[model samples]
Target: MKIQVLFFGITTDLVGSSTLELNIVDVATVADFKKSLKEKYHQLENLNSYAIAVNESYAADNLLLKESDVVAVIPPVSGG
Candidate 1:
C-alpha cells in the first residue's frame, strides 16, 4: 500500500524532502513502516525520539496504517 510520509526538522534535511510516498507491505502498522524506513535510511536509527502521526493525530507504534493515512516522521525539538 501507499502512504504519505512527512519529514520534519532534521528528518527533512536527512530525507532531502518534506514529503514523499512510502511503499509498504501488506498488513502494516506504524512500527512496521518505521522498520522498513530504518533499513533503507540508517539515519532514522538516530531519530528515536520522534513521534508518528496517523491521519493528523498522534498514534502508537501498533496503530494500523491505512492506505489514505498520512504518516509524519516528526523529530523531537532540540533548541537550546
Candidate 2:
C-alpha cells in the first residue's frame, strides 16, 4: 500500500520536501507512519510536538491508515 503525505510549516523544512509518496504495509496506522518517519527523518524526533491530520481532521495515533489516505504533517506554531 501507498499513501500521500503533505508537509506544512517547519515540517516541510525538516523533511526537505513538501510532499512524500510512501510505500507502506496495508495494516499501517497513523502511529506506525509517524514512527517510520522519525526513524527516517531524525529531525522530527527533536521537535517539541508533532501532529498529524488524516483526510481533513486531526487524527489519533491509533487511527488506521488506508492506501489512498492523505496525511498531513502539521508543525507546531509559535508566535510573539
lDDT winner: 2
Q: Write the per-residue lDDT of candidate 2 for residues 1-74, one digit (tens) a residue.
A: 98999999989999999999998888988989999999999999878888899999999999999988999999
The TM-score that candidate 1 achieves is: 0.90
- Which lDDT value does model 2 have at 49? 86
**What TM-score fits each model?**
0.90, 0.94
Candidate 1: pairs in clash: none
Question: Which predicted model would earn the best TM-score?
Answer: 2
lDDT of each: 0.86, 0.92
- In model 2, the runs with Cα more than 4 Å from the true position are none
- Model 2 lDDT vs. the true structure? 0.92
Q: Which stretches of candidate 1 lie over 4 Å from their true place?
A: none
